[model samples]
Target chain A: MSETTEDIMSATYRALCAHGFADLTMQRIADETDRSKASLHYHYDTKEELLRAFLDYLLDDFESRLACEAADPDERLDTFVEAVFGPAEADDDGDFAVALLEIKARAPFSEPFRDRLVALDARMRETVAAAVRDGIEAGRYAEVDPDDVARFVVTAINGSHVREVALDESPAEARRLVEAYLDRTLDRRSEPEVPV
Target chain B: MSETTEDIMSATYRALCAHGFADLTMQRIADETDRSKASLHYHYDTKEELLRAFLDYLLDDFESRLACEAADPDERLDTFVEAVFGPAEADDDGDFAVALLEIKARAPFSEPFRDRLVALDARMRETVAAAVRDGIEAGRYAEVDPDDVARFVVTAINGSHVREVALDESPAEARRLVEAYLDRTLDRRSEPEVPV
Candidate 1:
């Protein structure tokens, strides 16, 4: 992407975090970026188009960072959980969560957004599943269906985010629950031995 | 409530299910009820007021129904899960879920909406905790922290709703996962025997 394109995307993100999706406008975005509305329109024809691009940018950034941090299977679960529940770089006021919820609310109506979310969810699940599989193979975790465990982990994380945004609550309880789940399900030492 | 109030509320529900929260207008609500715009204004005063009233109505209806169906402790978990994941009364196109997502998205910014959501969540957690306590007392379930389990259950349900809305996907996986959780946590036989 060109410097101008990158600047526009950053401005869009700032505007979204500031004004939210409901009140976001092209003019507002342009003002945030110190560019004319025509310039924004020239880059992206519509608000949905611009936001969709932003989603793509965010997802790509997340996937790449996850790949880098998740190199060790033993630490993958902790890393993934932290990334999902931890504070964002520019999210001191929790505006990132708010903006995410706003865009997510549109997924049911917008096909592109829905597709992107589906892909993101699948990717996250896959990452967890791989970690679980590796743990089991290394005899560090119990032998369970990796896919099922992955889904449960993802669901817990998603639920935590929802609670955090809608109720202005912390994800501590959710984090603890997931940790308990992992301890119970993955720790083979805690399982009863089968009769020989 | 008066018949007039009920009629207006029903009309508002219909309009919301049709046009969603973003496009909802007093004129559209009046059209749905076959009442004049002036009448709607007299009844609701503003769109937010009408929506807040509708939310209260929905919550009251939910609490009453939950009270009726959750009389049996053994059936309480099943009933709550079904209510959260069941088909809606007026949701042939799944618009009920969409409308709910829209309203929930506003909770962070709308004090009335946030208060109502907090109350609803508390009631749900209390119901689950009560059921768990009763189960333990009756020797039907293992002894566990009812509050912790209740929070986990509520979080799973909330997360499933968020996933369902954002991906337009079914909650089957979430349902199965929660069922597994309850089986593991609540079943006495599944618990390891205490050493004498």
Candidate 2:
């Protein structure tokens, strides 16, 4: 991305965080950015176009973070959880979550947004499933269907995200709950004792 | 509610289900109802007020459904899950889910919506906690912190709702996954056998 594009994206983020998706306007984004409105429009014709580009940018960043190789299954799982849950403190204010949700709520109406979200969901699920498979192979986890568990994990994280953003609940609680559930379901330590 | 108010609320529901919250307008709602635009204006005064009333109507209906006494703990739990996950087929299209998500996403910005959602969450948690406590007392469930489990259950349901609407996933899968998890964690059948 060009430096100007990057600056506009950052400004868009700031504006989204400040004004929310409902009230977000091109004028608001232009006010946040150093560039002229005409320049911004030259790059992207409409607010939806700009926001869609922003969504793509976010997914690209997310994919890059998940692309890095992890040496251990636990580390992979931890990274996945951390990416979904983010820092505990970030959950308190929910600026990022609110913006993401604004886009998600639009998915039903917008085909492009729906497709992008589906792709993102698929990538996240695949990453987690691979980690679960690795853990089972390494004798570090219990026997369970990795695919099923993966779906559960994704759904749970999404659920937690909604609760955190909607109810102002701590994301830490979601993290802890999911981690504990994963421990019980996947951790070898919690596996039943063998018969004598 | 008066008969006219009931008719207006019904029209609002139809309009919401059709156009969604983002595009909803008093004129559209008026189109759905037999009443004139002026009448809708007199009844609602604003779109926000109408939506607030619609939300209250939903909560009232929800509370009434839940108010019926259930004798068994499992029955109570099953009812709660069903309410959250809804019918499996409903997940496929997500008309009601989309409208509800619209309101939930707005809770952060709307005080009335936020307070109503908070109250609904509290009512739900209290109901689930009571069932968990009842099960524990009756030796039908594993001993666990009812409050913690209640929070987890609600979070999971909220998460599943997000996935179902946002990604168009099956609520059946979410329902099965959560029921399985609950069985593992809370079901007496899954409890370990004591050594003789």
Candidate 3:
């Protein structure tokens, strides 16, 4: 994408999130991006199409991060979890969680948005489930229903984002809280006594 | 409340929720309630005033329902959780949570609304903390940081509503998932005995 295209998309994303879908307009997006109406219209014919593209970008971004590179399943899951609970970007202190939530809230009104969100959630749950199943096979995790446990873990992860935003806790503190919940619920320490 | 006033107010609440705060208007609320703008202003002076009253009304309604008559702290906590996660009233489904989230999203632009939301969250945390402390004293709960645990639990409860609404499962199935999570995290099961 061209730099200007990136700017236009980012500005549009923020407008939709801040003003919501009902309030978002091409004129508003143009103003937010400091681009002319012609430019905006040339790039995005309609607000709905623009929003559809934004949803695709978001889902792609999420999957790229969550698809961990670790060969070891334990390390892979932990890496994915840390990426989620940890800071989004080193330079930007503000997390994108709030923006993500704003998008979620808009889902009820948009079928495309709801489909993308649910699909992303399902993908995340499967990622966690695969890791848990791997751990069980390796005797690193107790024998439990991987699918059920994945649902709980994914719920906790998303719940942690809400908690962090609501509580205004630091990213480090939020990660610790989420890790604690995982440790307790998954019985991470119960695996055969091993030195740290 | 007069039947007419109650109907109008309820409609306003639902409108504020379905439509984002920026999109909310006196005319829309009046239309929803089958009332005229003149009648809406007859009861509420201004949009700002109406919004303030709406928040207050919601807080009052939530508190009334959340208040526990049980004398036992654990029972009281359980009752409060049940009240929050339980079924909505016949006419009020999915409005409260949406309204809260909309208010939260707009909070950065409105200091007063942000303060009210923060206050409400604090009061909710205090109630949960008091109950958890009592559980610890009675040996029903493990020794833990009551405040932190309360924050965790409250966020979990609120986020549960989102998951419940987003999932395809029936209410019964949703409740089962939430119940399982609570049992695991709260350690609700009786203590296990060591093999002799």
Highest lDDT: give the candidate number: 1
Mark the 10 consecutive residues where model 2 chain A has the least summed lDDT: A84-93
Q: How close is candidate 2 to the true structure, as a TM-score?
A: 0.89
lDDT of each: 0.83, 0.82, 0.69
Q: With candidate 1 superimposed using the best TM-score fit, by how many Å does residue B149's alpha carbon deviate from the native?
A: 1.2
lDDT of 1 by residue, A103-150 (tens): 888887789988888889999999889998988888788888999999
What TM-score, computed on C-alpha atoms, does each candidate reach?
0.90, 0.89, 0.81
lDDT of 2 by residue, B55-153 (tens): 888778778667648778888888887776665233336787787787788888888888888888898889889998999999988998888888877
| Candidate 3 residue-wise lDDT, B99-186, digit = tens | 5665665554566666666777787888878887887788776777888777666666645655544443234433455566555655
Q: After superposition, which runs of candidate 2 have C-alpha atoms over 4 Å from their true positions?
A: A88-92, A188-196, B88-93, B188-196
In terms of TM-score, how similar is model 1 to the real structure?
Answer: 0.90
Docking class of 2: medium
Tens digit of lDDT per residue, candidate 1, span B102-174? 8888888899998888888999899889999988888788888999989998898888888888987688879
Q: What is the interface RMSD of each candidate, in Å?
A: 0.9, 1.0, 2.8
Model 3 scores what on Cα lDDT? 0.69
lDDT of model 3, residue B54 = 75
Better of 1 and 2 by TM-score: 1
* Model 2: TM-score, first chain: 0.89
**What is candidate 1's DockQ?**
0.75
- The collision pairs in model 1 are none
Which pairs of residues have clashing backbones in candidate 2? A159-B159
lDDT of candidate 2 at residue B125, scale 0 to 100: 88
Clashes of each: 0, 1, 0
